[model samples]
Target chain A: MKKLINQPEQIIDEMLDGIVSASPSSVRRLEDTTVLVRKDAPVDGKVALISGGGSGHEPAHAGYIGKGMLDGAVSGEVFTSPTPDQVLEAIKATDSGSGVLLVIKNYSGDVMNFDMAAELAEAEGIETAQVIVRDDIAVDDPENRRGVAGTIYVHKIAGAKAETGASLEEVQATAQKVIDNARTMGVALSPCIMPTSGEPGFELADDEIELGIGIHGEAGIEKRKQMTADEIAAELVERLLPEVDLADQDEVAVMVNGMGATPEMELHVFNRKVQDLLQEKGVKVYDTIVGNFMTSLEMAGCSLTLLKLDDELKELLDAPSHAAAFKK
Target chain B: MQLTVEDTIQWLKQFNDRLSEQKDYLSQLDRAIGDGDHGINMARGFQQVAEGLDGDFDEVSDVLKKTATTVMSKVGGASGPLYGTAFLKMSMECKGKDVDAAVLADMVEAALGGIKQRGKSEEGEKTMIDVWAPVLGTLQEEDFDAERLKQTAEEAMQKTEDMTATKGRASYFKEKSQGHLDPGAVSSYYLFAELADVIGKGA
Candidate 1:
């Protein structure tokens, strides 16, 4: 309740307006939809990369739109899936002559809505393809794993491909490759408050933490007595390593993401353990990104995303990108 | 006899009223295990549905579909989509027709299936499943009578008081969730009981 805002009802809309106001000249909002597209969209025949989901995971879909990332992003209400019409609006707004590639997270509603939108877009004579990012190894079902933080990588590589004038097929192919190689796992110490209610959705005692939590403050896979930073990182990496073949490889682009309430110092402390653990496992991490990339409103905790990389993924990852949340 | 749109709206109104009546009890159940907002959120959504009631729909499907959209927009968390999709599926099954006991049965089956598919929770996993499974089992075994369905659903919801939750936030309690009824099951039971009462009164 001690946050800065006029009213909870207008938070998303107001924040979006603020984002557009501050946004670079390269991005513009699609009419009558909450989608933000590249200023000169369609790039006149370049394949477009579009990704979106709920709005709370900010600087995600919208912030990633730029030269080497997404061509556009459709945003829904906070923690709510974008409507099919909203997504279709984005597709139509960004469709130039080349087809569009949609990078969707592996959540049920997101998949279904995007699927319906893709069908509608196809009906409108637009070619649309999708790559679902299910990089969260924390979820038990490989077939049904919820898409966690690894979606950021999809935006990066696919955006690079589209920016370089790759065909729609080629862009989707590259995104799928990243999906197959990357893995993420998260832990939360507390639940986030829905802005409207201003009451925490779920509660945890001071001495416990939930591992493998979702972004919307859904219950995690397990809860254990709170432990040290190193131990938490070890537990997270233990679950994450099994998804990708890290035994023979060394290079990685590590993202130690703080789940909102966690501070940068704590993230770095967590990162140190991650570095040590990878080094011990003979995994050579060539690049590291440790910060808040995706968050659960104001939940306290962090997640680790390891992208086991080859030369190609590493290059695309290191490529320059600009967004409200990310600039490098 | 087929159920009319007036009956459906009356059922929704009664559902909202009953939810308000049992809000404190349901919130207590949720307090013991899950987030203590099942009654509050359910009541909020149904209240919106009640407000959105513009006379009556031409068909029960139209009524359910409008309720679905209202729930989706008004409710948050898994309930919004789970309940919304359930109603959407139910409406699809009963489109363009009045709802008889058999139609009600089919709609329930479709809604249950939609909840299972969407939430992916299993029977023993303590969720709304704790109440839904028993009520569904009872409904499927017995012929659909409004009075009979009300009695059976009430009994099933009461049974949740002795059961342990295995899914959602309540699952974390492991054994503590035992002896406390699941709030989700309680809210669902109220919805069904209200529907039955409305239908019976109209009939």
Candidate 2:
């Protein structure tokens, strides 16, 4: 209710306009669709990399569209998946016969919509491949895991691979490799309010926190008493480290991600324990990124993502990139 | 006995109105175990469908196809593609044909089939499939009873309250998902119930 928007239904449109306005030189919106593409798109012979989901996760699918990130990103309504036609438009607008690689999150809506779009794109003679990122380790079943902040890692690596003039298959393979090696676990102190509904996504008492939450504010695995920054960081790091094999002191690129409304100070506090805990367990931190790379509107929380890195992933991670939300 | 373009528009309009009225109810049902946007999504999609219905259309399939695209483009959720595919399949089945009771049954069957393939789901998953599957049988009957169709859809939707979901995000809840109505099933019930209303009016 306290949002500074004219109307709830216009949030996506207005936000898209604002993003394009801020970075007109880098990104552009596909006409009449909820899609943002790199300003110099269809980069001739390169395979196009497109990734996106709901709109609340800013600096995400759109903000990462530039030279070595994403060729395009389709936005959905708040916490909703982008529809098939919108995705198809992105594919058509950004592909240059090298084919396209769609970096899809492992949610039902995202899977179905992108799958349908791929089918439609293929019917129009556009070759496409997709990698489903199921990096959230909070779920008991691996197949049911939700893609969270770690999806950005896939974008970086895959987009870099594409920029290398790699074939669609090669880009897709690298993207899938990132997906297989990444894991994320999140905790939420407060729920997000959907602008249209003006309703909280979920409820949590002041003394409680929900662990293993998805970016859409879906209820996490369990609710427990709110803990100190160290305890929360310990819980996330412990759960994440076991998923990726670092038993031999393997190196990992760490991302201590804020879930919106959580300031940099708190994330750094959380990352402090994350660093110590990994060091104690003989896991080498290859690199670290701590910020709100992906968010859930104004939800107050944070997640820890671990990307078990090898020589290839590390090189790709360090590659040059430019976008509204990323530069390296 | 066969549906005309006029009749199809009436049917869709009725579906849109019902969804518009029950939007909050469907979302409330979803909040229990799912992301809690079903009512809002369906209502928004159908409102667009209703607005777009003013165009010139010569066949039922044309209207259905347009509605499919509108709902698919506007809904922007799991239900968007699911319902969009359902209508698209139904439109494909009814294309260039008179959609009588038997043909309507086939259309519903085709829609159900599309939903299954699109969602990677099946009956008894506590989804809209539960309602669509049973209602197909009633549509195929020689009697073609409107009341019976509505009752079957309502009963099927009610059955979801006691079952655990094994498909889509609801499946993530496992046992905890039981005792809550599947939001998709409830919205689908409104869809069929409105179809029955259109039939009863002999539109």
Candidate 3:
């Protein structure tokens, strides 16, 4: 209620306008759609990498649209799914003669809408392939699960493949590989307030936290008396490391993502513990990213994502990229 | 004859009152399985709906449309959009008529369609639809009574405790959403029952 806004209805639109203005000139917002793309996108023969979801998790789908990450991103209103039309526009806007690869999260609405968009895109002669990221070990659906924080890895890896002039099929295959090897888990200490309503989605006592929560304001798997950051990290890593195919000789890209409200200090503190746990498991950590990559508005929490790397995946992940939120 | 603006305001005021009456219960249900803001969110939305009413409208449906738009714009979160879209669809269906039982019934059906389209929810997903689907079934029957509608809606809301939520945040529970009513669905059912009362007996 005490936020700066001319009107509540205009919040999403206004925010999009601001992002467009502040973003690199290469990044352009497609006409009347919530999709953002590179100005010189679809450079002749490279496969186009596209990703998107609800809007509140800013610096996500949009900010990641740049040189080495996403070729385009479709955005919905806060925590809402973008219509298939919006996603289709993004597909068209970014597709050159080459095909496009869609990196979708596993949420039902997101999956349905993105799939519809892909079908529409393919109908229009734009070859499209899709890879769903369901790396959140927090949920039990092993094969067809909701995409969580591990989506960041897919974005990075696919972006690299596309930048290297990989075919759409190749890029799609790489993204699926990343998805197959990754696992993630999250915990929330406090709920976040949506900017328009100025009300928290849920309430937690000062001494409690929810485990195995989804990104939306939904309830978590369990709520228990609060534990230290180290304990929280241990439990999260325990859940994540088991599902990921990390072996003794495997190199991995580990991401520690903050769930909107948690501060930088906490992320690093949590990262330290995560590093310790991985070391103990003899999992060779090739790369580490600790920041607020994907968020749930202002929810105070974090999720850990681990991607087991083959030589090719590690190279793609290490490819140089420029996006607002990610730096390689 | 169509309803006056005053009648519209009265309905919203009563609706807010109904939300307040069930606020604690809704919050209690939410506390058990999901976020505990359903009661407060519903109350806040209806309160905003009440505040938005002013002057006379030519059609009862227009008033309903305004109410729907008001809640959609003012309320945030899933409840704001879903409930708001439902009412908006219902209002679109009710254009220019006096508030009659059949029209109300049609409005309910329209609202359900809007929810189904927006939420992509099925019958047993343990969302607001669980409460709504049953209530609509009862309302559509010849044996439907105002009291029976109210009672059945509450019963359906309670029945959510037995089903596992397969949508939204509660779905993460996998099976833990069982034994707890969805707070949003419970309040939605209450709102429906209250609207049924206002429309059913012509009180």
Candidate 4:
């Protein structure tokens, strides 16, 4: 209820305006739609990489729209998936001779809208490929899994592949590889307030936390009394490690992502435990990122993403890129 | 009694008014088990449908197609596509014709099929399908009429309070999703109930 904004309905538009103004050199918002495309879009002869979801997860779909990340990002209302027409405009704006690849998260709305967009694009004679990221380890049901922080890995690797003049099939396949190998788990200390509703999604007592929380403030698998940072890290890592099948000497990239309101000091403290836990298991840590790469609007929490690395993935992850949110 | 294009437009207008009035109630329901945006999303979608309805249309199908497009463009949530697809399918069933009771039943069935196909959900999932499926059954009965369909939809919407969610964000709540009315089912009930009211009044 107490936030800096003129009106609730104008938030997405005002935010998109600010994004374009702040990053004029890298991105531009499409006229009359919730799409942000690369400044020099439809990059000749390169497969375009596009991903998006609701608007609250800023510095995600839009911030990654730059040199070697997403070519276009479509945004919906807060915690709402973009409609098919908005997504189709993004596809049309970013599609070059090489086909476009859609990197979608596994939420029901995102999946259905993006699939509908792909169908629309195909009807217009544009080749399109898609990869659905469902890497959240918190949900046991694979059929109903929610994609979390690991989606950034998909954007990075697939964007790198697309920047190298790879075909749509190659980019989609590489994105699928990242989705297959990566796992993510999140914990929320408190729930976030939706701007329009002016009420928190859920309330937790001072002594409690929710484990396996989704990015959209959906309830997690379990709620229990709060644990220490090390205990939380252990629980999250224990749940993630089994799914990725990390072996001895296997190189992995780790990301300790803050959920908007989490501070860097706490994230690093959590990262320290994650590193120690990975080392204890004989998993080689190739690289580490700790920050708010993806966030639920001002929610007090963090998620950990681990991408099992091979030579191809390592190279792609290390490839030089200049996105507003990510740089390497 | 055959339903005309005017009746379809009136149904939409009435649904819009009802949604605007019940927006907070729907959001309250969603806040219990899902992210509390169903009411806001539905209100925004119908506002767009109202704006799009300004143009003249020849038949109920044309009105429905316009509503579908406007809702799909303006409503940016799961309900947007779900309701949009339902309207789109219903439009296909009503192409170039007025809808009598039999045709209305067929259109409702098509709308239910479209929701099932788009959401990849089944009956008993505590979704809008829970209301639409039973209404479809009622519409197929021998004495089917506007009053019967309205009664059946209201009962089904009320029944969702006792069911456990198995699809969409509500499913994430597991057992906690019970004892709360499904927001989507409530909105869908408003849609059908408004349609019946408009038709019964000879709009």
When sorted by lDDT, best at the front, the candidate numbers are: 2, 4, 3, 1
Per-prediction tally of clashes: 4, 0, 1, 0
- The B-chain TM-score of model 4 reads 0.97
What does candidate 3 score on TM? 0.74
- The predictions' CA RMSDs to the true structure, in order, are 4.1, 1.3, 5.9, 1.2
- Positional deviation of residue A28's Cα in model 3 after best superposition, in angstroms: 1.3
Candidate that would win on lDDT:
2
- For every model in order, the TM-score on chain A comes to 0.96, 0.99, 0.96, 0.99
How would you encode candidate 4's per-residue C-alpha lDDT over A1-328 as one tens digit per residue? 5888989999999999999999888899999999999999999999999899998887887999888889999999999999999999999999987989998888878888998899899999998999999988777788777888999999999999888888888888899999999999999999888999888888899999999898987667788899999999999889888888977778999999999999899999999999999889888899999999889898999999999999999999999788889988
Model 4 alpha-carbon drift over 4 Å, by segment: none
Off by over 4 Å in 2: A247-249
Scored against the true structure, residue B15 in model 4 reaches a CA lDDT of 95
For candidate 1, the docking band is: incorrect
Please state what fraction of the native interface contacts candidate 1 reproduces. 0.03
Q: Tell me which residue pairs clash in candidate 2.
A: none
Of the pair 2 and 3, which is ahead by TM-score? 2
> What digit string (tens of lDDT, one per residue) describes model 1 on residues A1-328?
4877897767767776777888758788876667888888867868988898877776676888887888888876666667667788889888897999999887655776677679779999999999999887765657666777888888887787777788999999999999998899999988887665566756688899888887766667677899999999898888777777765755778899888888899999999999999889888888888887878778889989988888778788877876556666
How displaced is residue A301 in candidate 3, in Å? 3.0
Report lDDT per candidate. Answer: 0.77, 0.90, 0.77, 0.90
Error of 2 at B36 (Å): 2.0
